[model samples]
Target: MADRSFLQWPFFEDRHRELAKTLDAWCADHLSVDHADIDAACRKLVSDLGAAGWLQPTAGEVLDVRTLCLIRETLARHDGLADFSFAMQGLGTGAISLFGTPAQQDEWLPLTRAGKAISAFALTEPQSGSDVANSTMTATLDGDDYVLNGEKTWISNGGIADVYTLFARTGEGPGAKGLSAFVVPASLPGFEVVERLQVIAPHPLATLRFNDVRVPKSALLGAPGQGFKVAMATLDVFRTTVAAAALGFARRALDEALARVNERQVQGAPLFELQMVQGHIADMAMDVDAAALLVYRAAWTKDSGAARVSREAAMAKLYSTDQAQQVIDKAVQLHGGDGVKHGQKVEELYRDIRALRIYEGASDVQRVVIARQTMGAFLGGN
Candidate 1:
């Protein structure tokens, strides 16, 4: 089993501990699924997670970052797809929960939290992945409605999501100041899923084309020129949870490696008895603990009323994801032939952990963010 001792750290409270225990029990009972039809699997997982009330934190007014991290970590330990299902629900509706009007919240949050409707975040474009300031999607205001025309690629829950929190250029100025956030429904005319993306690890992803989709003025989220701030704020909250998920994958790899080594024999002795094997285990253990410490430190900082955790969150994500890749690779090395087998847990983990480093924010992009934040703080003298 994955270790639970980390939950005892002072970073968490009694309620956080209780949340971890409950979600762990629920995931054990319900997380196993056939991922053959990935779209259907994601839909079902979202419904199951919502029905269990585990998704409430995603849409609630005051998000508990620690609770969100605990849930992602636990679900990820059980199934990566389960963790994906939960994360998308939160990300898809994060804008609404954090900055939507009361009317918008009433309409979407309940349905999204209940899993009656799916949600997606459509911020990345073909040209812009980490560079939000370079987005080219256009949302032109015409009378009381905004006419949206552009394509959003690599959108999670693209075709399946009932609604999307979309970002587009709404003004003439250059860079981030010209952007705006909007809530667009999938059913709107001219909005279509043009392609379903296939990846090494299957999930519901697609390219969305917005022809002349018109959304009422009420669909705008926050202010017309503040999309960048809205997006950054939302990322600051969820980025650390990505580290938590990586931590889960690493922990599971360690657990599988431990089990394999204890059972497998080498010349009448258990494989784990070998000094080489012990050394590998030691490295894996140290990396896992270190990643856990950084991940929870970021989570606790956000939960403690810090306005933005840009630096802490970036460091947590960069360190945990990069280290998890190493930990998983070592686990695979320890597994010998079985590690590369298609159905092996370590094999799946190798695939799952790769995308964590590249998505949300890539490891390289995170490094830039960390450097900028550090230099800015040092220059500001506080």
Candidate 2:
């Protein structure tokens, strides 16, 4: 069983514990594959996860950050594809959960929870990664519809998703005030997957183009000029979960390394018997524990009625993701040349963890967020 010690932290409740236990069992039963076909693997995982009722936590009435974190961490420990399938469901429907009308929720949430519809979030553009307010995609209102025109690149589940939570510039005002969020169905005319992106991990990432795509005004997520807020709010909830996913990867790497060192022999003794190897293991354990603290702390703070968790989430995402990269790298190093061998679990983990640091919010952007929040708390009327 996955460790339940972290769930004992004051950050969690019985529901969180229940979620962890349920998801742990589900993952053990479902995630028994090294499927090389990324898209097919993700599809099967999503359907299985949804049919197993593990996805209800993502689509729950209350936005339980703790449940989300626990589920992602557990799924990630078992299968990154499983984690991605669950996360994109939440992210793709987060606006609907937070701000969608009952009509919208009834329309999408059930489908998402049932795994009949795959979701994607389209925010990053070719020129706009961390700087979301600088997005150039236009969604001009035309009578009862909004005609979308522009591109969104690096979209998770882009080609495979049945729908997307899209952000576009709907006004001429400067900065984020002019942007709006929309729930654009993939079946709409003029909405097309421009190109499929091949990444190190090989998921269904793509560049999307909306060439005069017209969506009903009802597709608007919140309100016009609130896209930035909605997006940030959604990220605030999801970012810590990203850290949780990283934590899972780190834990798996540690497990892999531990098994290797305990059995792999070297210089008249097992690797674990060597002082240097022992030190490496110690560091790995320390990093994993530290990451768990930050991750759970962020989730707890958010679930405790904090309006926003920018600082805490940034700290968690930044530290956990970066530390996971380090932990996985160390694991690779510990495995000697076998670590670098293609198709090795450690090698795949090394590649998987690298993108976590760069996406959601890059580590550099997270640092800026942390420093600014620190300064604001210290300087704003204090």
lDDT of each: 0.93, 0.90
Give stretches of model 1 more than 4 Å off: none
Off by over 4 Å in 2: 1-3
Q: Which candidate achieves the best lDDT against the true structure?
A: 1
Q: Write the per-residue lDDT of candidate 2 for residues 1-382, one digit (tens) a residue.
A: 3456877888888878887887787777868755688888888888888888877867655798988998899888988888889999999898789978788899999999988899999999999899998999999999999999999999999999998999999994788999999988999889888899998877889999999999999999887899999999999999999999999999999999999998898887899999998999999999999999999999999989999999999999999999999999999999999999997999989988888999899999999999999999999967
TM-score of 2: 0.97
Which pairs of residues collide in candidate 2?
Answer: none
Each prediction's total of clashing residue pairs, residues at least 3 apart in sequence or on different chains, is 0, 0
Candidate 1, number of clashes: 0
Best by TM-score: 1
Per residue, candidate 1 scores C-alpha lDDT tens digits across 1-382 of 8888998999999999999998889888887889999999999999998898988999878888888899998888999999999999999998899999999999999998998899999999999999999999999999999999999999999999999999999985789999999999999999989999998888899999999999999999999988998899989989999999999999999999999999999999999999999999999999999999999999999989999999999999999999999999999998899999999999999999999998899999999999999999999996
